[model samples]
Target chain A: MTQRSIQMDEKIISRVDLLNICQDVIEKGNTLLTPGVADYSVVKDVSNLNLDASALPSKISYKSYVFPRTEPVLYYKRSKNDVQLIDVNIDSKKIVILGAKPCDANSLNIMKHLFNWDYSDEFFNMRAKNFIVIGLMCSHFDEYCFCTSVGSSPVSEKGSDIFLIPLDENNYAMKIITDKGKEFITPYSGYLKSGDENRSKRITENVKQPDVAFDSSEVYKWLGENFESPKWEGVGNLCLSCAQCAFVCPVCHCFDITDEDYSYTEGRRMKNWDGCQFGNFTLHASGHNPRDIQSKRYRQRVNHKFRYYVNKFGEILCTGCGRCSRGCPVSVDIKEIVSNCKNDQKELR
Target chain B: MKELIKHARELLENGEVAAVIGYRQVSAKRTKPVIITDPEETSALVFNEYCLNNLAVYLTKARIKLLCKKNDKVLKLAITAKPCDVHSIVALIQENQIDRDTIHIISFNCHGVAKDFGFDFNGDNLASKCITCETHKPLYYDALFGEVKETPQASDTALARIKEIESMPHNERFEFFKSEFDKCIKCYACRAVCPLCYCQRCITDKTIPCWIETSSHQRGNFAWNVIRAFHLSGRCTGCGECDRACPADIPLSLINRKMSMEAKNLFSFVSGRSLETPTLVGSYNEKDNNELFM
Candidate 1:
């Protein structure tokens, strides 16, 4: 690798300055009608304002720009013999999502294959491509976070256009990673400073320890070998089957497709997230259910990420953000499962 | 043991079953789902914990291919399922996802399978989900094997955890829980495993008006989780199927357990254990929980 000289400048931009820059960019995208999900905060942003600040003490922040809880495809009316496809309007524009964590952004690229390979989905693709993610370095790791186990880190930047390394309280050493990132920073290059040793040290010292510990490649082996191990019933028993973990996961990408028509024949096809926890995720229209039990379904979830996806994609389909555990009403931690699947603990008769 | 293979062979050879969908040892490390036909292949058929996939999901794709021609004779299939797997069969039947008589179900009483650890079953313990399963026996099957073993009724840590959270100051708990849930990545592993959660269309993926943000924000993640719980409200059996399938390992069961408990309290109904009666959420009564509308 050609050694890019390590350098840092002395000027520091406030969070307000960065956010203002983001706002102006969002404004431009909005006015331009950029096609995709924008990362800039929008109108009616009253509820979660200063959202990044709320996640204080944490190294990175979560963006407020979620796709949606659920959105209606379109309203329609049907007619006889003729199928009238209602105009499905998508208003999302391409945007630069600021301060997104590295782990959250990388999974989008990993998920691209499942949603778009066999089928061309303008839905997620449009929003995905439109958004240029700018990830910030993390200074901390949570117990539940296992980003490293899945091949990500506080410095991981596989999915970011531009990555910001914190050099000092007032300044950031911005590393332009992509041409898009260069385009993104051309206007604000004035805010960045020249590389310095102190700045580099700040970036280095601020980098947090890896959150998760495990070899994902080995997890596939562990899961494959331990299929009939009693671990399934143990972990499966703890499951409430609400599918919350799947909801919060970054890499679990199984969708069910359906066609909807208003009246008689006027609607577009729809695809939605389907959870393996649901018995229906594997049920056939022929009254056969393959994954009825929690143990079996849970086994598939683990195997799909560690074994099946690796068999197919040569990578585990998980990001290890710990969102599933945090958001899960029951708190079933995947990291613990990985650790316990080969736990040194012995069973008492 | 050859007799068991013989029965599978008979089903295949006599045309009673065009396919005997069972599991075979893929390697010393794992047993995967197999579509066996002809007696020669029957040697591969065996029941083991490594045969963990529900096998129900394949039926949709399999039936489509088997009964491809309009009203063409569908292949007679022989399948095996444990107790929990049987619930999906029941749910599929209730939802009309499949016809009951179209295929044969060779059931197992479910002796509490262990995870086929690296295809080696003896050392690896059973999956955690099976430990607390009250549905330790299958409700329906054409033929069955294994002895019915009683599963111990364990205390539910999920309900207990929910109670602890509920006991906290409402906003404090909400904020605490919300912060935790904010890390969601929107992967649908939980939905993929749920048996009763079968919806040809889900409301979460729509984009025209953007009901919920698809972005992986904390607010968006929390809303998705709440919506998920609401969608499964009364319909969820206390089976905890979604929780187990979660790769993110979210504690999804707390939501289902709460809803299941609520359904029992309000409608006096318990999910599973009975196919003769529909769930309280399946059908509505006049004096139902009208508090929401009120």
Candidate 2:
């Protein structure tokens, strides 16, 4: 399990050259995933992979590859007196995700903690284990971005197997971080070139560090005590109580299970993405909902990310990718909300 | 704009209302719904091209209950409504969701709002609903603002897109919708943003019998989306919030507008026009089409 680092020249393979890698993977009966349409679409297979990194962080994250929006878990059939169960087998295959941002790569670690916490999710674990992350250091940041505040930098390679720092229009300095990464890149050994000292220096100085919006430590403390803060109503009032935030978020992994029938003779059980913002998330069979209002539901979301997950797993749930704010119809910025929570008494209004 | 703010301030300052649901400028190009309880906060309210959200969404029993928890007495709300939003208010009042006397309607005359203020509102760029909108001045209002602009006639351009879909081969249309619905993440933003989607429990959430499959997969997404549109068939006010809120950018307005067209042709009915008549689906008539049933 030895790891090796190499420098690849832009002349060997350009930015669009990643499509060649996609082709290589596809030819080998593996999967290739790429950012599509500069937004939520993900094009699968080598022929379809758009190698544009201009859309660094896609509108939706790469979480869907590991935890699909919907997956068949099992199947069942009923007879006169006995019930038969059938297990749904998930095929494990090598998967390569290209153009994933550093923050999105880091999200895998955050999501992994919860999926394997009390009970292991073999479906997620199997896919996660087989998939390889090819992370690109982000060169762009919008007003909603605050990755620096959440302990992840633009180029932090916490979860990526292979990390790429864009050096120029057509080049990237690829750094192999793990034994898995070394093994993954062995097929492309021909492209490996001797490291240049000057280009390495440029890669470091070239990337712009995103400014830290607020201290998470302050937010964690404030959330621990202010469970019934009036600001929840003020902040949550505009929220549509929609799952846009959760579905787009890289680390939101909550899911619900249900069974669908083909007929009275057979049915298949499925696992689907669920959001705590939904009114039915905590509904009791006795016609009671503990969190009846949008304010309460919104409060749960903030607390779960900053306080509950921190307390339970000793890690933050958010990667600060800012997709939630960017895609929100009402423009509910999580950075602004967290900053206001930190400086509670000194109201921003 | 100043007059609207002053009116909202007076409602709050005089304790005439518990909260004023209006638009506040967030960025130069975006205005969002804001519930202002304090008179000073009324100054933040603005009505402009960017004010696109139907504030009538806040007029619900659950939402009103949340706003009134601070005081024991019945809470009064004053909401700024454009012509399209006033239609939703009328529908809600007719359905008995809100007592007419408990809330104040601050209506306004509007030509149309830009879908995105960042872009110009040319004929090609205007919101689809606005392209066919007939309401420039509200039919009902306690107080009104701005001059009545010319009410644009229903444009063939709006129906042209729907007609294009209709003109497509049946299989092609199915393929087109399947591809669009495939991208749906099941965020339910369409349901959450609609004022008329005020069900205490949505059918999708019911799991005892598991009505609609809650998955975002092809089959489940098709079922969920078709069911939602069917439920809102004659009742939808064509506000287009559902289409605007969709992160997947599914053309939800197409299905809604198609249903609106069916209602118009079949029953000669338009939703939210007046509170006197019941919803098309809610009431039955001797001339109602029973030929299909036979």
Candidate 3:
């Protein structure tokens, strides 16, 4: 693993220039992109913005850029003699999610295993394999932000092909972790700067976030013994079952597939995001809903993250991105939820 | 819930009820439904808020089994329900999906059952749904257990998160959601879990009509999710199940809440109260404005 640091002149090849650079790379048969739309990342002002590309700016969804909210999973057509299958294009373009946060980028591994495990889903894999992810460290915290608590720091490299650390004026300390990123950086060797290991290490300490801690080791045993705990019903009753927390969570992975019909014979199966917050998540098609009560549905969300995911993946499903807390409509904080799950309540039971 | 199980066992043994329909603990604290015709299996019964699954569906399935299937004796069954589960039962009854007289309902003093967050034990922390329940009472019953109490208030949206996002400039909030939406892998957890989303056929899946396009494109994804949310306006129960079920982690409640708030302010109706009442869009009134629909 030869790690090389680079000094990228902030303005030599501007983000817009990179768009052209991407276009040139594609012209040379290497699919790459400075993915943005006029409506999506076009910032009207950049006085305080430091990231290269702004994420999508509407409730529309970025999953479509990769997984797409809906697409023809496969298609069928009636012919004179026999039915013909029309396969939707599953190949994906290579693009750089240039300014992804560590939480979002690291989630790709979870996503990868999900689509790759039972059935190798070409749809998600196509986009995943092609995209070269570049993560930028967070410098400040927002009110709903809580990434550090879930074992991820702003500068965390748990998931990313390339990570960029903003250093002193006009420089970025870059670390390439994957061959995909390495290949992309080869042509940009001119942008390389000698290693400044001190500055690079300091980047992790530079982030600002309100520290919220919990003993990660205690989470599993507490849940194992407290299935009958009354605390769950109390907090779960407040839940609206809207599915927002999972929607924003970087690691929450659950989905369903369906078919779309264009005509008598033309139809496409599609995949879309599913959440356990809805009432019938566990409902048997026979109609029995295992998690019928709202409280039961709410409990599944927390247990899935802290208990179930750890049992299976040896890692928490959550990255402490705080996106769920920040995005929740009722203000349910994961930090508080995790705290309640601790064994401190043995006396209360 | 445990005492009732004992009674159910006796009834099953003596042929008082042809079958005792109830739940058995799957693990130390988890449970699964069962129909016991034998008295010896009665020892498996247990109760608590974790007995959260709705048994209404079983009521009908049991009846159907009685008619076309195995049993020769007249069937009577026992089951438990929470308020919301009762609501579904009432809806099913109203729709003539099930008969009430043939079944016995042993509703519990629902201490709001915790939700099933799909996680394994990490050592200590459990899911949040188990911690924040509202109602603790079961409103319907042929028999009761523990103690009846009132349910509390609940809403899925994280108020602090909403406030924080709301405080940001409109564009910033939009950007935040846009980013989240962009992350969506379109796994469809939201639709699959929604109780109100029951339709033999959903419009979004009709390619002939193309109610929605099938592209992962930003605009298309936004339209697909928003349209699905809007369709549930005044109909969504705010269970937070869809969010918990999502694999790609798209925050669907933001869409659900916007509709819920809009429905509350505009229509003055709440969903899942008594399924007898049609949801907002199911019926029509002269006092309604067609402007919003347009």
Candidate 4:
């Protein structure tokens, strides 16, 4: 595989012009998604777009736009002697995600390796191909955020097509990073004005990032060596075995397929999101569950993110958006858990 | 707070309890649940207004329950609970989900709790469950602590909103809930947080018959939420854990509160109040009202 070189073409757009560009995108009948107070929603009115650089990441990531929570793979119609199969019509609509946090922007790129690993999933590939991520520089940090430890930062533009740096309240300096971004911005070139790259670089440099909580490689090493540690039991006792963490995660992409019957003779095979925390996620037909205990399941969750996925794909499975810890019912902080993986005390801080 | 640590440490050191489930301060205004088995770790336990989680929920977890067994002998598990959380423990005992003799409760005269972790303990930040709370002191406890402070008063906006939803026309009300349920991602955090939802295999997860679709589409979400509320109709203790656990902010307790009202009005029964009285749904009487059946 060939590596794409970084393109450093810089441009500037006023806030008003950016909104106008968004409005134009909506006028073209393309889907426009922007961060709302809690989640990303369709942006029919550009005025409601929340581009606050200091706001925390949305409760749910925009992964569903590319990999829907539930979608049909194929439809089957059964007859007396034979069956007829109907292929699903994949939606190829161009989706423009504006104001995505840097942590969220890189999720699709991380997930792309998994979806295209053994067999190419056309469903995920089609939608991922049509995505245009407009990442905005983030200036927010909470106790739960650990993006810096996982090789990303508030100002990192690892996966965005067009990255935006807020120069001021009224202006933004945009850096086109990919050919797709350049192509997308060419028709709206009237809104673009050349800007100084040094100014934007200085602003990006000054953006405060969350302190690295733990070394990812140390966590990876600890996870490999301490698979049977009692720390798993402590976390498992508190973890209620819910999939909220996986569902709201930016890069946790495990799915299950089931067939649903719409009628006596016709039905569709659907693929839905699944999580490692669920007790039944690893249940077998023989009435035996290998990961029956929550401790083992919880161990799988941590090892998969920090160890196994890294070993297999050379990429960590988490973006450290902190949505899991922020929204946890039991207040189980993954950042705290991963940081204490090597500690003997394993105290809850 | 010092007294709480002393009591918990004594329980653990003397082998009176296998573990103590309590809250520990994580930040200035946030506390997270901590399960301590060692006597030395008891000092981490703290009780404050930020202890919003209902620790009773842990009593029903299979993994947590295993902590009660040591050297083939069953030991009691201690829990530090708010006054309202005791109701859930009462409900669990009444339903025969847990043995009363195998557990110990350390409760406080809670004034109220903050609405969430970071919020200040003020009128505006008072939890919805605390607004209508009638019990500031635990009805039952092995050991009690804390001075009985006056609970702050907050306007019952949740009840007012429930009334508003009730006043809507049939179609409008259905549409209102349909939209709210549509936001559900089927994460089941609500179920995971509720102490009463202790079923080994949830109805939604029963794929043999596929009673409820697992997909989070409109019809599936509607079936799951409505069924969940119906199952908890007479049994729910109104802890509002489900509401807080929902990531989509769907206001799920509205339906549970409405069902609780029906349970009170129809049967003159409030769940989890006493162990002497049999459960409303678990027991039946010949003279029970038949109007709903008609």
Better of 2 and 3 by lDDT: 2
Query: If both were scored by DockQ, which would come out higher, candidate 1 or candidate 3?
Result: 3
lDDT of 4 by residue, A1-349 (tens): 1114356669999999999999999999999999865579999999988888998788888999999988999999999999999999999999999999999999998998999999999998899888998999999898889899899999988888899999999999998888788778989999999999999999999988889999999999988888888768888788999999999998989999999999999999999999899999999989899999988998999899999999999999999888899999988899998889886756423
DockQ of 1: 0.05
| Lowest lDDT 10-residue stretch of candidate 4 chain B | B60-69
A89-123 in candidate 2: lDDT tens per residue? Answer: 99698788876787888777788888888899899
lDDT of 1 by residue, A36-55 (tens): 12122343222232223113
**What is the TM-score of candidate 2?**
0.91
Interface root mean square deviation per prediction: 11.5, 1.7, 11.2, 0.8
Question: Which residue pairs overlap in candidate 4's backbone?
Answer: none
Off by over 4 Å in 1: A1-12, A29-78, A343-349, B1-294
Native-referenced Cα lDDT, model 3 = 0.59
Candidate 3 regions with alpha-carbon error over 4 angstroms: A1-64, A79-82, A209-212, A346-349, B1-294
> Which is better, 3 or 4, measured by DockQ?
4
lDDT of 3 by residue, A233-254 (tens): 5455344455666655555657
Worst 10 residues of 2 chain A by lDDT: A1-10
Query: Which TM-score values does chain B get in all models?
Result: 0.79, 0.94, 0.67, 0.99
Query: Quick one: ranking by TM-score, best first?
Result: 4, 2, 3, 1
